[model samples]
Target: MKSVSYAGLTFETADEIADALLQLAAALGVNERSETVDIPVVEQNGDLSSVQLVIGPASQFISKPVTSPYNEPASAEVVERLTYRTRLLDLPRAAAISDSEIGRLDFDSPA
Candidate 1:
């Protein structure tokens, strides 16, 4: 049987994970839609062994208020200006040295 684990919880199958997320959302007074939840999943058959943190669907455990710099208009404007000014550096040309030139150069030269 496939299994997924997060925080201190373990869930077997996608349905169980969905139900658990719904319960968690309900506990936190947040409405969870069946179609909206995007749970991190990995499928494997046999005894429950591997475990990982669920990222997308589980937001109930986040104690701190999530903030984005882009959420603010000023920050977004600054980011946009910086991004617009950014330019890709031109590729440097490779040195074209012949075997005769290699022999002429010192084998041990200090930088």
Candidate 2:
């Protein structure tokens, strides 16, 4: 198993190191192509060791959208209409009714 050690703490796997790096990136709001993490280690005799971790070329969570011929971009109006339709569909039937119409409901009557 690959591992990295610094400041008396040892990360015993690449996954662990990657997770830590991701957390660090999130905390720092790092959305750039790449980022470096420097881990400083100091020994009892006052010797220092620097461990560098190169994060990445922007993980998928922060990566920019790639343009492709297969994907045609939609106009702002179209996007807004689609979003509005989706939100309308997501609402409960009762909530979708207008407030003025809601007062006309016959709660004492059975369906």
lDDT of each: 0.37, 0.41
Show how many residue pairs clash in every candidate, following the order shown. Answer: 1, 0
Model 2 agreement with the true structure over 6-59: per-residue lDDT tens digits = 344543322333334445545334333345555443333335444565544443
Instruction: Give candidate 1's root-mean-square deviation (CA, Å).
Output: 20.4
Runs with alpha carbons beyond 4 Å of true place in candidate 1: 1-17, 29-43, 50-111
Lowest-lDDT window of 10 residues in candidate 1? 64-73
For model 1, residues 1-111, the per-residue Cα lDDT tens digits are 123344666434333343444354443333222123334333233232323433333444322122222211122332343233221112333789999998889868875
Best by lDDT: 2
Error of 2 at 83 (Å): 36
Clashing pairs in 1: 1-46
Shift in Å, residue 70, candidate 2: 59
lDDT of 1 at 1: 19
How does model 2 fare in lDDT?
Answer: 0.41
